[model samples]
Target: MAKHDLDPNYLDPNYEPVVNRSGNHPFHEVLAARLQRRSVMKGTVGAALASLMGVTLVGCSSDDDDDAADSADSSGGSASAATELGFKAIPVSTANQVVVPEGYSAVPFLPWGTPITGAYPEFQADASNTGAEQEQQVGMHHDGLHFFPIDQKAGGNSSTEGLLVMNHEYINQDALHPNGATAAADNLGVRPEDEVRKEIAAHGVSVVHIKQDSNGTWDLVFGSPFNRRITGGTEMDIRGPLRGYCKLVTRFSPSATETRGTLNNCSMGPTPWGTYLAAEENWHGYFANSEVNPPREQTRHGVGSSSRYDWELAAGGADAYVRFDVTPGLGDPDTDYRNEANTYGYMVEIDPFTPEAKPQKRTALGRFGHEGVIFAPAVEGKPVVCYSGDDSRFEYIYKFVSSQPYSAATAGGYLLDEGTLYVARFNDDGTGEWLSLSLEDDDFAAKVTAANGSMVGDINFTGFADQADVLLNTRLAADIAGATPMDRPEWGAVDPNTGEVYFTLTNNSQRTEGQTDAANPIAENRTGHIIRWSEAGGDHAATSFDWDIFVFAGEQGTETVVDGEAVVTLDDDNIFNSPDGLWFDYNGRLWIQTDGSDAAPYQNNMMLAANPVTREIKRFFVGPVGCEVTGVVTTPDVKTMFVNIQHPEVDWPFGTEGDHPRDATVIVTRDDGGVVGA
Candidate 1:
């Protein structure tokens, strides 16, 4: 068969496709090999610099001490984090319940399928909750979340009572169904319509009002007006540049200004204006693109013949199910649901305070596979800057700075609609450049004026009809601009004190020999690392910056080299791999979470706290079996921490009442009533 004929995305009907959703890295290695060929010469200068950096970072001792290496690295890293952690590290565990340090306490709360509204319904012992029941109950797989104090004024951070907003990434089918899933045509894999609907309703975001009891323990307010669920079937608005794009026109909204629901909501970001940014990751798997002439954009994003859940095969052939089949029919695009897929893959904005408001997809942020959106410290009179990672093997990191300067009196979604979007290209020399994706940028227009590739003909990419086209087809624009691809960029956070941006590049097994980049120094990086950068001249709006490999994740005592220079040496207390969720506390300490597949000693996923300046990393918490430790936040006082433990097996949080354990949101606080992580 011809090479093109064998392409699963195009010709193959029997294609058994897989996109590596199991926190693996093999796909990244393969993509690195291909990109290395295209950008090999580009790394020539980077090799030498990486060698020098290896000497500076790789040979450090893993003594887990306070004084020895602290002074050595403090001079170069963040001064605010120069002090070491005050507590001893927790030992690794294989238990089926949450574990924490001796001085701290962890309590599981708000498990999935719990009710907080008038539509209250119990998650039965048989796990037979209907689609309607799941619709109003808390969704499954609680991920990232935030606490908004009910009494805190606008633009203020709350430390007392408030609403807890969170993301529900996906569902656990076995735990959500009775007797497991039963396809009507058992062998054919056709799921019951009601079962499929229930799953859809369980995938999205949840906002519930939470308050601290008189005893200082947190409890959910069962019937607060703020308690709401924005699920995959809820109505939403298609805002920003793509609002009226021709490609977004569909039978549901030919005007391209509206759509339905948000799915695959993962790692979240809370806006300074009190709203929440729920990122859509791996959303392509929820959609099945059936167009005969599948656009390269759709295929590259992983929208194909089949989906992970096969929602399209729901028995009733309802519009909700049929819409997932994005195959263009013989009729016009507006006559069918062909463009419904285009309406998704965005950073959705939701207002927890306003329960009546529909979520809005901010298209100007540029869509691919958004893990989350985090903002830098906002300076009065300065424009707001936000960063996002396109969570996939060989995807790119993106930045968006509002066009207008900050106005606390006027800051809102308007700032997002008018901005410049740029993609990161990390150089080997510890420095990087931000390539513009905006059509209005002179440099970007010049680079694509005559660009030609396998996807586009010998036409000028700058000739796109409008800015909406650039934003809607953002992934393509980033590729055309020569942005560097990364190994599954996930969640990101900014250091409040130094304004340094940190992103988690999860494991990438696709990287073959000699395909390693300085930021990703190891071959077949099953264990990931953290990459951080400071904008040029320390200006958040700058287009260039300096960067470095903050730390390499692996088993204790493991050593990694970059360009032949010995870099990171892991130790018992600091050893961790597949660093996934990341956020810096107000104290300048970075909290690292993982979703790893490491061996027994490192079997359970964990969370650690690091003093970057002192080079101190201490494991703080370890999760239960078959669970993901993700999404974390704290009250303004930093007295209590909120975290999400997703999809734990053998049931947790809700006890052994049901057939399976329930995923939950946990509250961690100091036993002495002191600030957490102090």
Candidate 2:
């Protein structure tokens, strides 16, 4: 792939600046305000600096005064006793029951069938949940969440009273309704309107207020003022170079000023400015189409596949289901829903604090099967940086650094106005470069622009109009710009202590024996691995970076067996496979979550906590059968951690009575647990 030359003109001088809040409020005030009711004791300055930089840094303190208090504890006492917070594992059985350790318990902060809006009838287990009704109810399959403290004055880790934002990745049709999805019936040629509505409602995200009692049990405040559900039906603004672009125009919002809600919101991120970044993944399978009358710009955008679902053929399908087809039809681009596909894919930002605020689809981040977005710590007058991964075989990883410095004052609104988007190109020599994807660069244009002055060539540029268009169609832009293909890149995080960016390249089965190369050294990478790269000189905005494999997924010891026989083994560590969700806790502990492929000896999906610098990892907890451990977050105080357990053993012969399926969030904390990863 040819490297694109940087275009200085693409740099927007008039870009909005990031707001910084560090100086406006005292350090303690900022921490207290952000943490809310969470009890926060003063830690060493090193810990504060590490958290501020967005890197994982750990510090242990010894105080003789606490020894007397420690001896009275049930777990026994010693200097090392301070580090051992007795955490009990809760087993949430298929009965929709939440199990936890002896001293701890679990409750539904928000369940799967709660109502959200629009007079939707109460969710019925036996009756069909219409698409519209589904849209008005709580979405299914909750995953990856964070608790934002509602009260600015609340202190300590128990400041559990806050807004809980969770991702509703996708719905299980068989378990969602009394009967399976109407769209799945053999007699059902196309998806019904109700089914489409239900599917749409199941996408995107949910935010609700939650509080814990004096006993440390958590519960949701139903219909709280801050409780908001953002689904496929929500109104969202298109921001960045693609805003108002013709390619995005649709009949619903002819001007392209706004569009419907986000879809497939998987793992997510929380902004320093108090908003949530929900990622859209596995979006390609929603629409259905025929080659004969393909959308006018279908080929242009690389969505030439026949509809993945035949929703367009059902009653009221054209209006709801057909929009996903993306084939251009009669009527002006602004007057038809053909361009609806162009609206999705970007990272949608929502203010959990403001229920009525319009969600913004940040085109600057570039579009793909986004797994999650994580930020690097922001310094005064320094760029705010974030990293993302495209969760697909042979896709790519991306990073975005805001062009403007962050300020707490201006950070509240539209802080994502402008930024530099770069794609990672892992080299054979364990080095990587952040390839610029900005539209202003000549090299980018030369590669992206058609020879005849069209936005796309015979290859179909996907009918993009400008830079915003390019951003919305980021995958295509990256392809045209020659970004390196990767193996199923997933979640990523920037170490607040060391400034290193870590991402998961979850297995790529397409790689064959002879196709092995130094950059992607392993072929048939079933077990996957974690890759870490450091920006040049620890600078987030730098174009070049160094890279290395932090840990290879598989079992530990000599010739480890995968299933019944030995497939691969790790001499250094004993671990599980398919690393998925990842996050760095407040104390700089790297939490790694796993998914899929339970090799025979392996019991179940699990989560791990690691010391990144030492590359030492230990299994923290495992999930029940047929569940993936994903979307992990720790409260500001780090005493509590939340890990999402999604779709436990979803298979065939679905039923709602005895065989009904349930997905919920699990809160993990030590029985006598102090700060997590301590």
Candidate 3:
């Protein structure tokens, strides 16, 4: 569907401020003036502000050259016909049915119990899947994924052969066994290590190879050479600023030389260099506390009794169980893994090309519940910029500006090291400032030291040990630097052709009533909007930038009448709430995905596609009952698209009469058999 035509009344350029009865503050006044100016802009203010900031905003010129190079590398073939470019919606209901658009067919490749790595018994649907057994089997709840062609010479589109790297964000606890997870009480003080180990093993990432059959169906290559699993218990090396910092040390690895496993592998990104950047989200719920009080260091990190998870109370619990506990264990900080919490929350980079390579947790990018990382258009001799969001209430949006300029010779090399992290401060007046969270700044350190007293330093003191330390504890640094708190930032993408950055501000219910402000203008922002910003001078590394609300969420007609009279508003144009998953396809078409928990008015989550440059948007597909549409990736040809459906019907009562589990990945292709969004 096309966007609603803009009305003339809303286009008035000379409109003045309509004073509200509410009392004014200096912050509000500045914000009001900014919003007034933004209402008149046709495009982002980032480009114009770039000149003032003395940074260059990379634009269409660079992208044009990249596109030319990509074209030259491809075999000369006419673009796929429109009929071959269409997308078919698949209905994967809880009844275990996989539906596809007419004329297209689908086959289930790997189910929950399929064997991948060891000599394990074939999955028994009716039997309990042990933690150790689950480790040997395929992970549950497949989420974000990418299909990489094994041979680049064969073209990077979806082929009959290649390696598929998919993230199993989490497992469905209810579906873990024949019945459900065995409670500590039920187990009678005899917690099975295998059970806990199985759960941990299921929590990371899975890599497999698949081959398209002559009949056009896809199936897993059972024992493919590249197939591997990175679980929570696997050994991984520590990299970045905090690599060998005292806080990251533990009894298991006294020098902090290495750590065990990666968990909560959510949405991911693949660098040009072929490494995978997996984001860690919701990792706070894994630890627990003992009956007795723990050490001072644990409390220092906010790992107190109330902060612990239920799993900690289980039998056989100790340092292994307490490691998840943020509570400082007694004795030296290095004595236990209480400090281990500091290690997680950073982006873990894994070289899928080399399975033996230790995954590096790039600390240059500040840490938090990183939703995903999207790279800006790479420019020769210019620093590469990557955008990320802290996916939590009142968190901040961040960007990493690499210290080294882009060199084709090292395009896929180790450039993740040595970069500056900047958090966004979006102003109401369409302008924004990227505040640096640098260790060199004394003021920044003082603020952090005050909030987190464990940090030892003064206003004039640079307390950070190094860059890795800053990245590992990014949230602390961001708070000290006073970054703007956004609603809930998720996936972000940069328009290849226009160089505009689009990020999702997922809904925040706590923002109701008292939290209303100029930048966050609405109370109870249930339907989150998409925010776009251009770097000053078109450079991703600029300190200052300009931004604006590209879209606002709400019911289609609910916003048409503000104060009982019809007024032109953004809510009328492509109004959809809680924009979550986002990506830019090779064709430069912007795809917007939604994840709404509120069900009454909105039946289920959905996905939409838009042309940001033209403001043209359409509702492309809607998901089945109770699911979040996440982790979207498109082939280089833009002909095939893969979207993930995560935790469908998550709230259904456990063991209830009507409960049903929904989780799987479905392929969407056109009914006319054409490329998607052609």
lDDT of 1 by residue, 1-678 (tens): 211223333211112133322222332333233222222112111111122223244323325446445435633653453234767788888887788989999998888888877678876767778999988888988898888878654545667689899999887666777755554346355678888898898899989998888799888887789899899988889888898888988887888898888988888788767789999877777777755657654765778776666677888678778788788878988887778888888999999989999899999998778899999877789999999998877678999999888877777777888889999887655567898997778878866675533333222233456778778777777767777777778989887767889899876766676766533455566777777888999998899998776766766545534444334455567667788999887777789999877355577899998766655678889998878899898888888999899878776656555555688988999999987886
Error of 1 at 675 (Å): 1.3
Model 3 local distance difference test score: 0.59
Top candidate, metric TM-score: 1
1-678, model 2: which lDDT tens digit per residue? Answer: 000112221111111111111111111222222221222112111011111112221111111234224322311222233233234322222332333445643333345666655563576656466666766666777777877878642333345778778888876665665655554345445555666667677777888777777787877675677777788778889887678787778888877878877877778888877778998776554544445645423432335444333445556555655677665567788656666877777788888878898999987787777888888877778888888887876567888888788886666435566888887766544456787787677766666655224433244334446666567656656655556666578888877777888888777666575754322334465667677778899888888887655655654332311122322223222346778888877666788887757544345777766655534345566666677777877677776777777776642122344334666667766667566555
Task: Give the per-residue lDDT of model 3 (tens digit) for 1-678.
Answer: 000112221111111111111121222233345432222211211001111121211111112134323322321222223212233332222332333445643333455556777665466655465666777776766666777777742335555566667777766555555555555555664445555666677777777777767755666787666677788777777765666778778877788867777766677777755667888765544544453654332222223343212445446775455466555567786776666766677677876656677777775676677887888878889887888887776667888888788886666535776777888876655678887787666666565566553432112323456655566656656656767766678889888766889998776666455755534455565766677878888877888887765555555333222123222222222345678888888777778887775354444677766655434355565665666667777555654566777666642312222232535566666555555775
User: How much is 287 displaced in model 2, in angstroms?
Assistant: 2.2
lDDT for 1 in candidate 1 is 21
- Best by the lDDT measure: 1
Better of 2 and 3 by TM-score: 3
lDDT of 3 at 510: 62
What lDDT score goes with residue 469 in model 3?
Answer: 59
Which stretches in model 1 have alpha-carbon errors above 4 Å? 1-55, 58-74, 77-83, 154-157, 187-190, 453-463, 514-522, 560-568, 657-659
Predictions in order: lDDT: 0.74, 0.61, 0.59
How close is every model to the real structure, measured as TM-score?
A: 0.89, 0.78, 0.79
